[model samples]
Target chain A: MIDLMQFTFMQRALVAASLTGAVCALIGVFVVFRGMSFIGAGISHASFGGVALGFVLNINPLYTAIGFCVLVAWLIGWVTEIGRLREDAAVGIFFASTMAMGVLLVSLIKGYQIDLFGYIFGNVLAISRNDLIAMAVLALLVFLVIFFFYKEFLLLTFDAEMAAVTGLPVKWLNFLMLTLMAFTIVLSIKAVGIVLVSALLVIPAASAVQLTAHFKKAIIYAVFIGVVSCWSGLFLSAFLNIASGATIVLTATAVFFICTFLSPQRRKMRRRIGTLVKTQNS
Target chain B: MTTPVIDLQNVSVAYQDKIVLQDITLSVSPGAFLGILGPNGSGKTTLLRTMLGLTDPFDGTVRVFGKEPKKLKRLREKIGYVPQQSHIDLTFPIQVKDVVLLGRAYKMGLGKRPHNQDREAVEEALELVHMTDFADEQFGRLSGGQRQRVLIARALALQPDLLMLDEPTAALDVGAAESFYEWLHNTHKNLGLTLVLVTHDVGVVSRYVTAIACLNKRLVAHGLPENVLTEEGLQAMYGCDAVFFHHGKVPHLVVSTRDPEKT
Candidate 1:
């Protein structure tokens, strides 16, 4: 594994994993806090349509995926704003429709397609220079946006009504969040694949929330967990000749479980229950 | 008289296609402590939201600081708003001090972190609510009354001339609720700020607020509490069976609802 770092593909894969994990985990904090997990899942699945269209039209799938993901994300945001139905309901509809479109589009393509399979299940070790550059640029853009709008997004996630009443452009901020989420999902698709991309966005944040009572600390922990899981999972997957995405997700899940087991809230609840039972018996 | 800070003339508001507030006209003067009284689903929260510009009215106009509350960022800055306790997402993992600090974000301008002055303001606000001890506590972990106080501190941290609270004591215990009302009354007295408190608690309205607005999809009455807290006015807003009275020359207020509306 140490010697493999000298190879460009291994290096690119490691960088790709870290970049995807960090960006997704950062956006995932807001998504989890705002209870937009379904949107994350929906947008990732929806990006599949763009990837399919790219294959069908013979264009770069990244552009198409970003376009489709943002459009679907905005539509979901619109549905939420117009109060048409619940945001999750909109996601549920779009989730199935996009996957269906992707499947039909894939079927239209000729014989065996290994590139399409990579998009579906991911092959981090097969990452190219172009993919790495795209991922870095997109990740940097996300980081800049998150950095600039950190306060607004925090207030928005904590309480959007207060954010609005405090005179923040909550509507614009909300749409911006969706756009960022869309971008994060698209950039992440190559590393984790369209199928498990939401997990990359979700698990690290979920684990972080379990470990800390503070929001800022939680975000830091999420980024740490994300980068650590991705890097270690890449090494472990290579050593075992297994799938990187699956190993990374499983690693994150394990961290979440450990955090849950050591959670102070869980301990507090256990103590409270013990006292209650003892008093009742007395 | 000093100019009214919040003026809504013939305002009609609808939420989710259901008419909530209709033909409402209200004026809050400086230093006036006003209570918005209603039963459940009486559109009390909608009225406050309309004033705060969170909910756009279907008809008429809502003017905060003589401008549309929705359009004027300055209007939002000048008015402190505390939404309904349930409206907050309890799952949000935030500390009490951070919540209070968020109140200063707009004042600090775009893309700026909290400065020293903002930190002092947060501490002052937390101290005002007697919640300095819970400054580091996670907001979601606090008890209902404690959370209520933290929310009030967040609003107070804005240092606005006008403060509007929607059912602020809904989650508070009896003792905490009384203390909060007392502190609010004292703050109104000392700061000379306009306050609009929305609640179904008739006793609270009769006790703390100097003025009253009884609501039931319309402005049933708005005047000094003594002039508006009559039995007839209570019935007008809260169906036919509502009551308000005194026992043996002692001041007492009770409201009985035969059919309480769902919020």
Candidate 2:
């Protein structure tokens, strides 16, 4: 029963976590709907190469990771356009190889940077002003990208060939969508580790889907779920002296299960109070 | 008659190790309903893909309005497409209006929102398909026939001069399929839009289609239904007896093949 307003770090942690959660879940709506979950996963791991490169080069890891992730996102789009290979297989090979390369690079660097583990699993307590600013900018970018091309991306995801016939550059628009997804993945990577990034990206939206029939409402609900998970996880982890990222993911998973179980739309039959008693007695 | 809107001359398409289409030549006249008929593996889809410029021909060319199909941006504006129902996963959460709005993607300028014109077109397309009431509905909840109508509205929203539908009635009940065909014919006649349908049901679509192109591994026949769907043509296309059953206006071709075990 601790008051949430007392500590400055706790407040910052809550704000940062909420922002990251909302952004990931917002983008996750598209990821799950577009069947781009594999690509989203690939981008998360691929950004590891970027982060490792930043460490080896003594640069701001966030900038380096964002750049690297965006580049790989474009590459995935290129391969998909060429149609020389299956999209999922191509993304799998590239990300797996890049992740291996990243791990190898991390070990090869001179000193033991223990902060690396924090980046992978996240340290919500260590979130800085710079991280907050970066998250805000990336979140804004995601909003704009989604707003401007909502129709095109929607059509591209559902039926690309028809989108193309309508004169939309379905190939280029798809590439742009993947690129945005990469940026969103990179933004969440610092808050949630690469391994758990997709959880942040997917869980809230998955939960929201149980409650809403409209895409716009689903997005709004997902963002709400995301913010709740982030703040609750931060507060609970602080109380328990536990890892924040894992705690937040666990919270989101719980929310998803609860929503799924209690979803009225999913029930086989509407429950009347009298009917429930009759069934139980029978 | 006006010059053919689509003309393919000796077009061929190949995958890594295998050729999917070979030396195909055809022309689709303006405002004519052309049906491309073939069996499952007969490369009808490949031909449509090549025509759309999504697949490059190994040799020869595809022309839309006398320009290369891939390079003609303006010409593409006049083309609408509804690919096979199997190609899309209905679980994706896209609204019907959002799906229809995709038809405006090509016409929309960079950074511009869908304007009044686009909205009107979407509305009109929905009205034409009798789906105006479901504009707000999530596409995933629609029945198969309803989904097909939404898809048709999406294509129709493009305001294309030519519409290509690939197995548009696949996985539909006979009543639903016949109604779709009737809607397609009405739209084609009313709008003066060329309609191209790729299907296995030549007999079913023959009445609406002004012409038929019977294909197996090759162009077996290409002409009026009376000429292209003869007994010899049916045997060549199906490799068996194709019994034609008529229910007033519609024809159903039922294929009965000899047992392969006996052969």
Q: For all candidates, state DockQ relative to the true structure.
A: 0.73, 0.58
Model 1, range B157-185, lDDT digits (tens) per residue?
98889999888888888887888888889
Tens digits of per-residue lDDT, candidate 1, A20-137, equal: 8899999999998888888999999999999999999998788799899999999988987786798889999889999999999999999887898788777789888887888898
TM-score of each: 0.94, 0.92
Q: Which stretches of candidate 2 lie over 4 Å from their true place?
A: A1-8, A80-83, A268-282, B240-254
Docking class of 1: medium
- Candidate 2 C-alpha lDDT tens digits along A1-282: 357557666766777787788888888887887778888888888988998998999987888888899889888878766767778987987789889989998998998898787678887877778877887798899888888877676667667777766667766787788878888887777677887887888899999988877777888999999999988888888889998889999999999999998776766355566689899999
Question: Under the 3 Å rule for N, CA and C atoms, how many clashes does model 1 have?
Answer: 0
Q: RMSDs, each prediction? A: 2.6, 2.9
User: If you superpose only chain B onto the true chain B, what TM-score does each candidate give?
Assistant: 0.92, 0.94
Chain A, candidate 1, TM-score of 0.93
Locate the minimum summed-lDDT window of 10 residues in model 1 chain B.
B242-251
